[model samples]
Target: MISIWIYATLFLGFMVLAARSDARDLRISNRLTLTMAASGLAAVGLLGGGAAALLVAAATGAATLAIAWVLFEFGWLGGGDVKLAGAAAIWLGPEATLAFVLATTVFGAVLAVLLLVLSRWDMMLEMVGSHWRTRLTADTISVPYALAMAPAGVLAILARFPDLF
Candidate 1:
């Protein structure tokens, strides 16, 4: 329980890097998320119950690496987002990851809708459309979506896995 605060601080440090960096090379988000997942468990383990925490830590680490290779590299999603999500999983563990993912998906969808609704079509065209016009246009990145969804995921995990807490 107290360990959750430590994990949150670590995650926040990652966010600071993401906000400060002007380029994509830093991979601030990806690494941060991964750290959150792996360390979150280990920290809990420090409170005792080593076996489950270590198992989750290992599995989440592997999954984070795979995600980095695919999603982050492909630019489908940011590295920080990937890493942060994984870290949150460390706190939630395997059984809760699913619910957390579902929460993230739904939260992301709502955010996307909100962004679309807030902007007029003409403005949208000017912003996203121009980028889309380019054959290799990168999708518009939303730090808030990732940041906001992470905690929501954590809550979702907690809700689903009360025993873990």
Candidate 2:
């Protein structure tokens, strides 16, 4: 039981860090994603998921990578976003993978609308002159999709362990 709490905390912690980094830098570092994947696998295994956890994580990651590749080709996602989502899929596994994807899609749509509105506001756009902000405000580039992916991943995790709360 205590291990469950630790796993949840670790998952949320890494997700938060990834979200923040993606928002600020317009990039999700591979180091963070890899660490999150490793810790998540450990957590799930420690919580009695065993080899099933490994298989699920691997399958989910591979599937997400394939989908991400298509999204990347269409200029709908960044490479960092692809890596982040694939790593996050490992944590979410097969059972919650659909929920995670749905949440991410919903959140991404909302974020896109929000960025669209904010981009039009000179005041909002001027608040942060960072490269990320520029990319967000630009009409051509994609948003930092990890912003949506991470939080949705957290929600999926929470849903997976409803009794934990």
Candidate 3:
């Protein structure tokens, strides 16, 4: 039980860090994503999930990576976003991974709408600092997708561990 909470804390912590980093510079570092993946595997093992559970988690992560990579290639998502999602899927496992992906898609759509609304407000964009102002004003919009990923991950975690509440 204590291990589960520890895992949750670590998972949320990484998600928050990833979101913040991506929001600030639109970059989710390789080190951070790798650490997240490793910690997820470690958490599963520590919780006595055994080899089969670990294998399932790993397979889910791999599948997420493959699919997200295709999206990245098509310019639908950034490389960092692909890696982060894959890492998150490992923590979520197979069952919760679907929930995470669905929640992330919904949150992403909401973010896109918000960005469209915000883009029309030049004053608001200016107040957001030059980095964001430039990005928001660009011909092609690039969202900090980690923002969606983080909250979706939280929701997935909660859904997977209803007893935690």
TM-score of each: 0.59, 0.88, 0.96
Ranking by lDDT: 3, 2, 1
Q: What is the C-alpha local distance difference test score of candidate 1?
A: 0.55
lDDT of 3 by residue, 24-90 (tens): 9899999999999998888877777689978988999999999999999999899999999999988
State which candidate has the highest TM-score: 3
Error of 3 at 147 (Å): 0.5
Cα error, residue 64 of model 3, in Å, equals 0.8
Runs off by more than 4 Å, candidate 2: 130-133, 136-139
Give candidate 1's root-mean-square deviation (CA, Å).
Answer: 5.9
lDDT (Cα atoms) of all candidates against the true structure: 0.55, 0.79, 0.90
lDDT over C-alpha atoms for residue 97 of model 2: 74
Over 1-165, each residue of candidate 1 has an lDDT whose tens digit, in order, gives: 455555545544544454344133324545555555555666657745678767865686567547644866776566566665666556555666667667767766786566555343445556654433331232453434454454565565466446545
